[model samples]
Structure formats: C-alpha cells, structure tokens
Target: MALEKFMKIKETLLGVDIGYDSVKIVALRKGNGFHQLRSSNIIAIPPKSLQQKSADLDKIAEAINTARKTARPRISEKLAVSGLPESKVFTKIIQVPQMTDEELKTAVPNEAARHIPLSLDEIYLDWQKLGENSKNSFDVLVVAAPKFLVENYLVLFKKVNLELIAIETKGIAASRSIIKKGEENTIIILDIGAEATGISIFDLGSIKFSYTIPHGGNTLTKSIAAALKMTNEEAEKLK
Candidate 1:
C-alpha cells in the first residue's frame, strides 16, 4: 500500500512570477505536513524587449522553457501558479457587514462594482475575507484585472506547455513569502522591480493595503545616465 499511498498524493505547485526584465520560478513540496521549498530559478529577459504593446512574446516563452528545464529534477507535471504584473492589477481592502460566506458571495460583486472603474465584464474579480473588526464587520481584499490581460498570460503559458492553476496579483504573491501564518504584527513589504515598484502592508498575515508605483530601478538608471552624460547601457552597468 505504500506505492498506492504515494500515487494518491497530490502533485506539488510551482509558483511563477514574470517581471519586465526577468522571470522567477519556485517549486514547493509538502514535508512533515508543512510546505517546504524544493527548487527555484530566475531567468533574465533581453533589454528593451518588454515595452508596452511591443513585448517579445517568443523570447519570454523561451525563457520560461529554459527555467522549466533548469528545475526539471524537482518539478514534474505539477500545476503552476502565476502572478500578473503589479502595474496591471488593482487591489483594495474594503469593509463589509459580518455575514456568512453565502451572503458575502452576493454582496461582494456589488461592492466591487463601486470600487473598480471598469465594467464588471471587462475584468476578472477575486476576493478573500480577512477577519472581523472591533465593530463586528468584515475586511475583504478585492482584486481585479483586465480579462484580456489575463487571457494573454494564459496563452503564453499554453505556448510553453505549462499547466497554470491560478493567476494572482504580484503584491499578494510577495506577501505570501514575507508573512507567516497567524503573525500578529503589521509590516510593509516592498518589491522593487526593473520597471515598477509594488508596496504592500501585511497585518495579521493578511494584506491590508497595496500600491504600485511606475518608477523603479529603470528610472534610477535613466537618472544616472542623464547626470553622467552616458548611455543607458553604460549607466546600467555602473549601477
């Protein structure tokens, strides 16, 4: 029955985060009833290839394929979770009356409609119930991303032959790595990427607020290039 039990066990999950200038992949396995990291890899993208409306899809797919091969020994045919770029997603924490999940299910959409600027049909929505407050109200985290943007990511994963199980916002995924279960103290997690910076506040292991700024490492590089009268490439190398 040992072999049977092993066969019944579920496959582990691979987490993927694709940034403007790099792609990161991580695999986790269950050990002693807790999740432990198995392997991780990061692949860099070519310069000037991730511009808006002009991203090099083929290059990204190849990088993902390479990352998969790099971690082949630790990852099998497991499902993967990916995160959309923080610049493209919207996240907010809102208050609602404490109620059952069934009631929240019906109430969330209406509440989201007020917060999200786009039409509901244009975006994919997801939410999580945080906890009850002093007033016996619930704090819910809402996430919305354009449907077309999500579909493009799905297409990219399909091209690489990767099975994507879920897509989350970058801030949420980063919070998972920085916060521990049942942690009481509040803290801020900052992710400075090549093209954007994402800031998130975690309280009691749940994200209470998140914000994304367009300025990042690239901006600093450009400033250095201007100050020294050097090309971007030279400034980047100096940085």
Candidate 2:
C-alpha cells in the first residue's frame, strides 16, 4: 500500500568513530520496525598521532584504510555518521519561554549566544525542544561543536571515500547504541576510550546530561608506569 511504502526505511547507516588511539566502524540496516547490525570493527591509530592537538591526517587515513579492510565487504551505503570527541562539543539544557515554532527558532539563536562562550560564527549550533519545564518555560538541549574540528572530520571521511551526513557527540551516539526505544528509566552510559572518558545520562531515550573527563586508560597506564617504575608497555600489561 502507499502508506506502507511511504513509511518504509531504506538507507543503511554506517557509523565511524575515530578515537584518539583507534578507529571503529559499525554498519547497520535500518527498517520500519527495528535496526539490524551488519558489521563492526576497530583498528589502532598509528603511533605518535595522538600526541598532537590536531590529529595527523596521514596516520588517520592509514587507520581508516586498515579499518575498512578489517570490516570487510564495503558497506552498501556510503553515507556515514561520525562523532566528535566530548572535548570538542559543548552541550547544555536551558529553559526558554514557550512560543510558536517560528518564534522559538528565532529565540534559540539568541539564547545559545548567552550560554555558549564561543562566538556564534565559530561553532555549529543545534537545539532540540524537550517539552515544557515546571515554570512553564520550554526545556531545550543546545549543542555546539567547533567548526574547525568538524571540518577535519569531513576531510577525513572524504579521504576514506565515505559521504558524511551527520556528526554527533560520542556521548549521544553511545547512549543511542545501548538504549532501547520507549524506555522509561534513566541510565548513565560510560564510554571509556584510550585518551578520554565520556559519561552520559540518558532518560527515556533522551540525553539528560553528559560530561567528559580528561583521564582514560592511557592516564592509568602512565600513573602505573610512574608508581611501579616500569615502562609504559609493562604498565599496560599490569592493567
């Protein structure tokens, strides 16, 4: 029927997470009822690439190349979703006066300017209305990701031959992968990677709040190395 055809979902979304120490690729087929996972793989980033503030592009490209080979039989849909590190994204939930959609669209930018320390031109801003608050104002989740960092991901995806469609913070993506639809409880999702740790509180399928700590496994390794007077490699094994 036309209704069924209209509601059908067709695109397969491939998620690529390029972490400080590794690259991960996940492919899923989306349908009207549920999404099915097709493939997933992770590969390590080349040495010294993680030491810099901006990643080394040549090393990143090499990691992606290794990931593609490990994940195998290239994904059918080239369009992909990528995540920014927590350090690169700023998220806040604020209350604003409830108004018409058109009115709120105008007010959101003004409100975002107040909360986000960066200039509007320096970041990509997005907001989601989270219904009304107790005081009759609207509760909105605002997200701001730095433009230069976003551009770096776009360039990386281009080198890997993937069309980038969506860029979300890693906390949101972690909660989405683990949380089920229509869930009524609140849960904290923790993603501990090589160089950073992201903690997100998800309530009823929405992210209530998120925080990223600077420490990760690498930090522990360094601490252990110093305490035990061992090399980094030996401390890693102790972990």
Candidate 3:
C-alpha cells in the first residue's frame, strides 16, 4: 500500500479521490520545503452510480477524466496516487518475533492469514515494520485489499491515462495530510463523506483503528427531505 517509497520524486503529483458521490482531483507542485496546490476540481456522480452490485466503470472513469481536465488544463506529471475506501481495506497491527527483514518477508504472509479474514488468493498484501517491543517482538502493520476492488482502480486509472503510483487507505491519507506534528496523543478523526463516514483512531503517529458507517451526509439529507416534504436538492442546500 505504501508504494510511495518506490516512486521517483516528481515535481508534481496528482491526487485522485473517487468517492460515492463525487470524483475529486488535485494537482500539487513540490516546492523547496513545501507543496503548493496547483489546481483542484470536483464532479458529482450520478445517484447510486457506485452503490450498485456492479458499478458502471465507464461512467466513473468519465467523471474522473472530467475532474482531471477541469483541475488542470495540462498536468505535466502523470504520476498519481489514490486511496481505497476505509471499508474496503483491512489493516492490523501484529506482533512477531524479532527477525531479519528477509525472514519477515516470508513470515508476514503466513501471519497475515490469521489476522485478515479473506483468503490469501483474494487479497493483495503489504506490510511495514513498526518497531520492536520490550518483549523482543516487532510490531508490523499489515494491509490488504480485495483483488477485484484493486483491479477496478487500475482499470479506472488506465482509462484516464494516469499512472497510479500508490494506493493507500483513506485513513492513512487523511492522517498524513491533516494531522499536525506534536499532536501524537490519541485522537479520533471523522471523515464525513457524502455516502459514508470514516472514523479513524490515530495515535503514536499511526492509525490504530479505522471503521466506516454506511450512513453519511446523504442519509441526513434524505431524512430532512422526508420530514419537511422538500426535494433532496432543497434539503441539501438547507443542510
């Protein structure tokens, strides 16, 4: 999941966030010691476009392309990064006997099967060594995503001609982007999206837990519309 380590430093990086309600794109230029936002855009998706059993990849891809074009007329760097929804990704922190990197490579896969509910064949696995504990055990952060879900992302990015350099969990991306330094005390982050809400517990400079609720802003809007006998659009504006 942390594919950024393998990427060559680029002048600009494109961020693509494909949500249930909208496709968002942002271009950032790396500066001397900071990043400058070049341009950004958001395009709404058709209602229930992503909630169906089989999503319409074509329409989703089209929305992403439109957002990219509107975000920046011509982004020089095609390298991009995207996030998998918190609900679709599985993450766990496990303790293992301290071992060399080579040994952990083989050990992690065997260990992951116990922590992750899905079969090994159904997921793409990745891991990072956190640090050693007092008991001489290493804490490793394991991440996995369903193969089909990841393939859809690849296909969508292919259709839009952006090189997907990395795919991170939404919680990781949010913490990295917004959490300030020296604020390492345990804190909860609530990401309220249109169709879902992501709750993440961040502490010691990493995410300890992440959960998603199916209800979000759209659900509230629907409730308001029903109670007031107003249109969804009107309720949305009022909200």
Candidate 4:
C-alpha cells in the first residue's frame, strides 16, 4: 500500500496487524518529536479459522473489534494503518534507464510485468525511484499485491468500524522501526511470525531486498513435537 495524507499532526493513530494466529492492535499518540504508546492488545484467533476456503469473516471481525476496544485508544474517527504480510506481496529491486518522472510512470508498469509473474490487471503496482545506480541506470523498488487480497482487507476493516488510511508492507514497517537513520552498513532483518518468516535486507537506510519463507514458529513447533514425542501444545509452550 502507498502512503496517504489522511492523518493530521499530533493525532492518535491505531496500528492494526492481523496475522495467521492472532489480531494485534497498538495505539500511539503522536507528539512533537516522538510517538507515545497509549495501549496495546492481542487476541488469538481460533485454529484453522483463517485456513478455510471461505474464512470465518465474522469471527475475524469480532477478534479485531475486541482487540481494538481492549486497547482503549482515544481515536474518535477510528483512523488506522494496517500492514500486508510479506508472504502476500511481491517486491523486487530493478534497474531502469534514467528517465523523467513522466516517462518513468509509463516504464514502471512495463518493468513490473516483467518481474512479477501475474498479469498487470490482476495486481496493484507501486514503485519508487531509489536513486541513480549508475550513469545510465537507476534503481527502482517495485511492490505489487493482488487486487483481491487488498479488497478483502478493506472490507475486513470496514466490518470493524475502522478506516484504513494507509497500507504498507510489513517489511518496510519493520525496517523503519528497527533501523537507525543514516545507517551506513548493510543489515538483514528477520521477522519470525507464527506461520511465516520475513527476511529483509537493508542498506544505507533503505530496503534493498526482501523475501518470505512459509515455515515459521508453527513449523518449528511441529518439528519439536515430533522430535521430543510431545503434544503440539507442549511443544509450543516449550518453544
């Protein structure tokens, strides 16, 4: 998702992260120089509730509402920002010939089709010009997500009475939170979640590359359970 100018200065913002295992909500008050945490809450989802062909949207909506109320934010307008999981997005860094902004707009979609497996009509495409990579070429970060996936999120948030102002990839959010400004060295970030792991490489404060692996905590728990001859619950607790 691209950034939107929906928030005002010093307004309280809600961060909603819906994952495979749980729904998490964080409220933050924006200050002059920093953000203050107001409240945070997490509620677990029923197992396999989100794995079905047709997910239990009512159940998921209930969890989101419960988590939001439990956090107790002072948001009267219910404005929020959500993140798309890395596993559900396609991102790549590509080099393009130096061109003006008007020309780059036409070039990015053509380049996106070459890199992304899906047709251009099926996905929402966004790109940013990183900088000049060479005398004749420049680096462009291309991000794409399926249209249906985004529409589903919009509907889900509507069910919870929240207006999703902006949506971003989790990898970008993690890098912004964890990386220091003006960092000179390259670093890799590993975000391990219940069902997936996000691997992001950052160089000089920008994300250079990112990837997602299907196996995560759940996979580890299963492996541990098999190796130790314990129940999955026991393995989870031990882990």
Candidate 5:
C-alpha cells in the first residue's frame, strides 16, 4: 500500500489542498455537524514551474506546519495526510444482479477485471454498494488508483509524519457539501478546482459517471500568464 510507511496515525486530520498558486492546509477537529477548523491557511509555492515532481516533500511538510502555526499558534500535533487527484483513479457505477454478501464479494473482483484494463494485482480497487431499489439491480460505486500514485502520496505524507485515514477527492467532498437535491432528480456536479475540474453525474445520490478535465482555473492562470507576460501569481490575482 502507498501509506504503508506513513500510515501511523497521529492526530485527527490535516486536509491539505495543493492548489496551483498555493498550498493550503487545513487542520480540523471534526465535530458532529461541523468542525472547529483548528487551523487553516495558504502557503505560496516556489516561483517556478509547478508540474508533477516539482514540489519538494520536505518543504511541503514545513509549509503545513507553518500554516498550522499561523492559523492556530498553539497546535501541538501533526494530522492525517490527505490525497490529491491521481490520474489512475477511475470511478464508475455498475448494476449487478441482486445476491447475498458472499456472492457480491466474489462478483466484485470479477466485475473489476471486466472493467479495469490492468490486472487487479497491479492496482488497489475499492468499491461500495449503493443499496438496492435502483430498478431491482444493485448499484456499486467503484474507484481504482494506480499503486505508483498511491505510493508517491504516502511518501509525502510519511515525510510529514501524518497518518492517512483515507484518500478522497475534493470533488466528492464538494458534492457532499454543496449539492441540493430536488425530489431525487438526476444532476451533474461540476467543480472548477485550481488544477482540474470534475464532472460527476448522480441519479438520486448514486454516481452515474465521474470525470476530471485537465483544464481549470490553473489553466486559465497559465494562459493569462503567457498572454500578459506576467508571473503565475500575478495572473492568479487577476482572476
């Protein structure tokens, strides 16, 4: 597993949002309906090309601690590591015949093989059943991330000494927060994040399809930077 090294959990959770212009870290002492948001802030990245492999794990860890100190000066512990959008992640919902838990258990891997191009051994596959009553067939939400990506993320998390409970997408979190249901109608949710925009269509709370496009606010910033001959920071401020 990617988190095998850094999986030793410490605090509650440290939600790290790696934006194009800035790296934002949020420390949340979660509550029932809300969280204290113990600490939160944005840290500027080095002034250079910020593609993959450009970020230094040590510096990112330092920034997380710095942001926490700036927001809540008395915080004492490191939190769990969060995940970014990995390219290998594939999300889908397929309907299978109703069966017992034992049957579904056996069927999921087989279904994964039919859908996933690579062997199940090459990837970490996770799935959830969305309950019955979707026209008699069971609906399942599935996610697959390449082992390499997971490993890279865990390496960074371990460097920061933050235990990772789960790796999730901001798009999923956004849907959980901002979506408004109207009589169980199908809807497509689009979140224009700094680096990417996600499109997820859900019919009555079940995902039909989910996709992420490379172009986003970051793309716009880069375009503005190139056109206006300005730095990414300047172009981002113009946004």
Candidate 6:
C-alpha cells in the first residue's frame, strides 16, 4: 500500500530503544492490517539510570513524550514497544541428528543439557528450527535469558501503562531491518552506536554470525578526552 493511502487509526505505537546515553522513539500509527509511519525522534537520557537493575520509568516516559510533541500533526497514542539490548542475551546454534517434529519434543531437554550451562528450570528457554540438515538432521538456534533481566524490563512497561507487544534482542531487530531476504549471502552489516558496534554476518538470507565490538566511537572519544586533556564534547568534535 502507498504511504498516504495507508489506513489511519487513532492508535499510536511508540517504539523506544533504550541506549546507553539516550532513549529513541520511532512513533508509528497502527492502521488497519498495518502500521503507518507518523514520526520518529530521539531524546538523551540521564546516565547510569539505564545501567541499573531497574530502569527509571519516568525517564522513558519523558523521552516518548518529547518525541511525540516534536512530530507534526501531533500524536495521541500512548502504547509503546521497547527493545532489549543484545549484550545480555544468550544464543547458540545446535545441530541434532535427523529428528522428526515429534522427536524434538523428547530430545530438546537432553540437547539443552549439553549446550546450556544452567539447568532447564533456571532459565527461560526458546528455540526455533532453521531448516533441515544434510543427514536429515535439524538445525536450531536456542535462545535463553536470565529471568531477572526479563522481569526488570517488564517493570518499565508497567510503569507507564504501555503494553509490551514483544521484546527482542538488539541483534535480532537490526538483522530484520538490515538483512534482505534472498539477497547475496556473506554480506556484513555493521551498525555503530554510542557504546558498541554490532557486526552481523548474513548468509543465504539468514544471519549466521552476530558479534559486538566493545570499542566504539564513544570509547575513542573518551580515550581522546583523557589523553588530550579536553572535554568529552571537544574530544568528540576533534574525532
């Protein structure tokens, strides 16, 4: 559907990506069978707040409020979807001998024991089949997360009455936006952010490898600030 011809609805969805030094919101309108682009913007959040065990919900609310105000025509939507950073996520690709869909029901626990460090009861686990293997085996990527981190984020959503549709790790969201289906394989997508840079390796329309570099532009700016005796802003400008 064309952008202007898309459905218009009273509902607006705010997508907030909590970054190290800021919170960004890509406000979207939920139309019939689709979402229409309203407006998108970002706001700088206070430091050390997002790093805590619990994020300050007030700050998140404020950032969304700001972005909504800045967009023209104004937005009346309050529902928001938040994204989780990838650093805390634990993921692994596992290959098992040819097994039917029914066979996996019985074999997952055993396979999980060999691959996951925590007992099955200790973690919230999820897995999806990628495709079939050469020898009639199955290829699956198992994802697990600490219960505490998951709950910590849930609290943020509750504070503002913003419904949480789904929480996705940073790598997964970036891959969806950056990687194209049936495109040339072996292409690398690099996204440079404030505290880290994500390196995703796409192969055969799937993300095969995802890595993050601890060193980012901010790190280099900090290095320059300390070495050259300048303020952070000056160091960043020089860089």
Q: Is candidate 4 or candidate 6 better by TM-score?
A: 4
Q: TM-score of every model?
A: 0.81, 0.84, 0.87, 0.91, 0.74, 0.78
Q: Pick the candidate with the highest lDDT.
A: 4
| lDDT by residue (tens digit), candidate 4, 146-228 | 88777778878888888888888899987877888899999899989888999999999878999999989999999999999
Q: Per-residue alpha-carbon lDDT of model 1 for 98-214, expressed as tens digits?
A: 888999988998899998889999889989887876577878889989887787777778888787866787777767667887889998988888878999898887888888898
The lDDT for every candidate, in the order shown, is: 0.79, 0.78, 0.82, 0.83, 0.67, 0.69
Compose the digit string of candidate 6's lDDT tens values, residues 206-228: 65666678667899999999999
- Tell me the lDDT of model 1 at 143: 94
Q: How high a TM-score does candidate 2 get? A: 0.84
Candidate 2 pairs with clashing backbones: none
Model 6 residue 63 CA deviation (Å) reads 3.6
> Model 5: per-residue lDDT, tens digit, 1-239?
43323333332456776555567776766465445567677887653212355456666667766766777544445656454563336777777888887888788888878887778887777888888746667887777777666666677678766766667655555565466655288778887766677888877766778888877888899999999999999999998
Arrange candidates by TM-score, highest first: which order?
Answer: 4, 3, 2, 1, 6, 5
* Full-model lDDT, candidate 4: 0.83
Clashing pairs in 4: none
Model 2 segments beyond 4 Å from truth?
Answer: 1-8, 29-34, 46-55, 72-77
Worst 10 residues of 4 by lDDT: 1-10
**Where is model 6 more than 4 Å wrong at Cα?**
1-12, 30-36, 69-73, 102-106, 113-122, 226-229
Backbone clash tally for model 2?
0
Question: lDDT value for candidate 2?
Answer: 0.78
How high a TM-score does candidate 1 get? 0.81
User: Which TM-score value belongs to model 5?
Assistant: 0.74
Cα-based RMSD of candidate 4: 2.5
RMSD of each: 4.9, 4.1, 2.7, 2.5, 5.3, 4.6
Cα deviation at 234, candidate 1, in Å, is 2.3
Among all windows of 10 consecutive residues in model 5, the one with the lowest summed lDDT is: 2-11
